[model samples]
Target chain A: MLTLQFLPYSEIEPLSSNSRIRKILNLVRENKIVLMEGRLKPNEETDLIQRTMENLSKDFKGIELCTVYPNVKDKFLKGLLVNILIGDRTGLTVVGPANIVKEIKRDPNKILLLTENVRRKRKK
Target chain B: MIIRLRDFISNVFYKLFQQRKSLKLGIYGPPNAGKTTLANRICRDWIGEEMGSVSKIPHETRNVQQKEKIKIKHKRKELTFNLIDTPGIATKIDYEDFLKFRLPQKEAKKRAKEATKGVIEAIKWLDGMDAVLVVVDATLNPYSQVNLTIIGNLAARNIPVLVVANKIDIRKANIKKVESAFPQYEVVGISAEKGHNVEEFYESLFRLVK
Candidate 1:
């Protein structure tokens, strides 16, 4: 069963500055696809991507970030277009494909586990 | 009768093709800020008849009050504006206030939260509007949750806004303090009842829409 989620880009805040990669890693493990929609600062985008790479397991195929431009119409991209205030400025839409969506749903708790583990590491 | 028949047919065709254009304007402010009075005055003046019932009770407009297709002239051009009037955004409603409304304890608590949520939703709905008119009571202190939230959200979204300090006819009306509070935006003072500065209100609106 496919579940649809509307994740606001503003909700993506850096848990800590210890390791940018760990944060994205944690997010991907729990959710099928972390839909990154919103105007992200340069540093924020870098941190998100790094964290995603670190957290993704070998079984995880790959993560794809889809960018949907404003006022453009393509039938193929219609379902994925999510109107969101990106980076607190520009408005844009985003859509992710089935495989990436599936991965996030399969193991929702992985994100919490990864976050907790990373927090412990930071303390040490 | 041929001319009459042609006119009738054209009218039908025009009705079929005419798209309904509604300019959504949200009226928002704090409790006892005379938000309802302003809404009442606008509705009265637009239709030349009263539609929204006026009241002194705070939160009289508990949910969004919507009046559709109100016609206004701007720079010799006529336009339809839809007015949405909303409840005052007070800090979390205390249990006692909720109980005063005579709701069961549980329901009252739920309703209190719902009211706050409604205010937030109203602000969110303003995203696509052509303009927002933030109604502030001239007599009241300017520092308030609703005033700050509505103004800040509109500024953040870059939505065009007009701050109206209503009830200026009251002896207590302190329009200057309200004006100073929002230096970035020009504040217009008006008595929604006596129709004072009403023309100026429309003029400012004309400039905005143009």
Candidate 2:
């Protein structure tokens, strides 16, 4: 069975970058796709990729991550003022394990998440 | 002594110009995209040497390799820069994947650990580069997330980039696909291994530095 978990920005706001990455990685390892309310910082994303590479093993492959942010260029002044105040919390991030999530293709219009089917054997 | 003073001032300006010519050009792309091959080709063409070793296995280049003071001359136009060939960036790196290449368990794990470090180092070196050669495997899909992320980061920094669609000798190589993927940037197709259309690539380098 496939699972999709939603994590709000507030839930991770208080945590450090490492802690937030760990929390999301744990969910991805369990084969659950995490839909985060806000995107990670740029350095945080690099750290997450490095951490994922370090944790790759037999059962766990890694993660497929992508973020969709609104084009605030159209409203540059308002966007800049709002960013100055609230720290640019305006995007959705998706993280899924590579084993289960075959691919996550995102264009300007929409996202196409493809997954592979795995059959479990019944216990004897 | 006015003539002597003028010569000294001219020498100072010449040194400064030489310093400005030493731009850093980084080669970045996904795994097995022929980055090392291209770096070696560039080095051999100019400096009569090779930069790094190449292998069919992914992550063979698990560290950043650099060749400095490479000068290329084309049609009386010359450009000098430091060439940095970085490890291929990837979202996933499983040690078991290395075992498929017949590597021992211990060796594979060590390679994976070094590869993770290499990826971080490559990203960290981005700030120091003056120009970049974003290498893409012409036979593969050009719209991958890794490619997009690397290009996006460079664009955000307003860095000068020249996309190299490598391996045009292969049957499945499609330069048009890569061109369509990055329409905004200039894409040059070349068989880095076989040395096809490399003269055109060298000419493009002059435009990139400018």
Candidate 3:
């Protein structure tokens, strides 16, 4: 089963965010796929890579990352406000175990289509 | 819910720490392409220490070496990064190739094995790289199979890249060939060994990450 827990961009984007990322890393270690609500800011991205590199081992097979943006079919100011109000409306990121996510191509648009198509196939 | 409270708490913490940070810069190229020469020069200029030793052998740097916290200041802007100097990458590795270099059979095989492992490690390190400097020997034709392979891998990962046309101090060095070969990416010509045009190289590198 694919499971997800939402961690806001606000929580993980801070400079002194090691403990918060540690929390997320622990969840990943337990084989839970995490769906973060927004992109990891630049500094946070660096920290994530550093933390993830340190924790790599057989029991923990690292992670595969993918991101998707919901095409709301709008432009300009409306899009800007919607983005501010609903984080990751710009792009939602999904990180899962490397072994699992590798078989799934790392494309945001195709991820939804593939998941829904699989769900339909299983129901039938 | 706890999620709402957590968001409020994190927002408070976020304000405490935020600033520009360093990038992890990697240097990669084929064997005998002056990769280590460039690595040594960059370190000598910025960190005031050499990152690694350089030799004429095919695979002198058989392991990845790193020098942390290299800060470069040009004009009013400053760029800082953790520098990773990787081994020469090759498509094929045979122990026999080292024998031609006049090494004993036993030592040659050992070096070849280590060099192959180093190549794998360098490619794996790509995932962690924020940007890469592809050092090409300008005295030779830049249209080699190995150079193309390295560029293709960087393109696949979407990592920022800058090609360095090194060895320009040599009589045969031609920057135009290297530039024409990789027109898509910015190419800077410099004689890393002599430190000629090194300031221009530094400026181009800073611009690469910016």
Candidate 4:
């Protein structure tokens, strides 16, 4: 039942500007759960989350938003990404791509947004 | 056979005696969301005693609070109510301050991490309840993490929710804006301090429970 939607870092502005994004933002404004994906520089992620909260507070009525960070294998990167997703429900788990993992581990609140890989048994 | 029959009769009597229903109702909101205020109101009105403390500081009711059973009669029906007050939902916690709140270090750390977790738990708890009342601050911006999370989760579960817009006595309180924000909800604006609109709230609750 879990749905995954991916948005690359470069497309964030256009995605956010889209009317669909506004509708989703309104859902967040109304205190609904939303999962966002993008490649964000450590600092940019933090600033963007904070700014989004501030704007939502001012413009929306009776809505609240929370962000979750996914924890990948790289502790440092995970920490950085985790920081960006703070102030909301986040999951922690190891994922693919060490560089992305390092960014995610930097932030504390990010949970592993990705599903775990299962190891298949080798035939004797 | 005579002894066995007597024992069975006594057991039936005991079972009848112990059969009492207490409706479980949860009061949830963010820090300073007026959960305690509402708890106090219910206690004073129904039980004739104020059981919970009210404070301006957020997270005053850090621990889950349960009031003594209260009995009220509406439309000739008798009901026993047990109200539970929960900690305010917040995005982040200052670990040091949380520690100073007298929670054991280990427990505080766990709870600190569960700030969002607590909100989720509160939402899940609402699933089995007879009704849920989501309190919002009328004086502050209607939108915030606690308000939305609680409402959204409850709505998703299809639980009957009653929105209480607290602190209406303040000059800046905007009842209309709060209502507009939750257009699909049955929102009632009231000042918990002065007990304004409280009767209507109780009446609405009676309708729901009935």
On TM-score, the candidate that comes out on top is 2
Q: Write the per-residue lDDT of candidate 4 for residues A38-65, one digit (tens) a residue.
A: 3333223323333343342222312223
lDDT of 4 by residue, B1-210 (tens): 999999999999887654436677788887786878888888888778886777554455666767745787766777676788776765334444466667787875565444434444554455566568888989876654346556766666666788899998889999888887678888888888789988788877776666
Q: Evaluated with lDDT, which candidate comes out highest?
A: 2
Q: What order do candidates take by TM-score, descending?
A: 2, 3, 4, 1
Error of 4 at B196 (Å): 1.4
Q: What is chain B's TM-score across the candidates, in the order shown?
A: 0.76, 0.93, 0.89, 0.77
Query: Which of the CAPRI classes, incorrect, acceptable, medium or high, describes model 4?
Result: incorrect
Residue B157's lDDT within candidate 4 is 62
Over 4 Å off, model 1: A1-124, B1-21, B49-51, B74-77, B98-114
**Candidate 3, B1-210: lDDT as tens digits:** 899999988977775432236688999998888888898898888777887788777888989999877888998899888889998876445566688889899998788677766776777787898899999999886765357657766776899999999999999999988988788999999989999999899889888999
Instruction: Report the number of the highest-DockQ candidate.
Output: 2
Ordering by lDDT: 2, 3, 4, 1
Sliding window of 10 residues with minimal summed lDDT for model 4 chain B = B115-124
lDDT of 1 by residue, B35-144 (tens): 67777887887787654555554455567778888888756877777877777754233434557767688976565555545545554466666677788888876644
Cα displacement (angstroms), candidate 3, residue B87, comes to 0.7
* Cα RMSDs, all models: 15.3, 4.1, 15.4, 16.5
Q: How far is A54's C-alpha from truth in model 1 (Å)? A: 35
DockQ of 1: 0.03
Which 10 consecutive residues of model 1 chain A have the lowest summed lDDT? A106-115
Clashes of 3: 0
Candidate 4 segments exceeding 4 Å error:
A1-124, B1-20, B75-77, B95-124
Candidate 2, pairs of clashing residues:
none
**Model 3 bad stretches (over 4 Å):** A1-124, B1-20
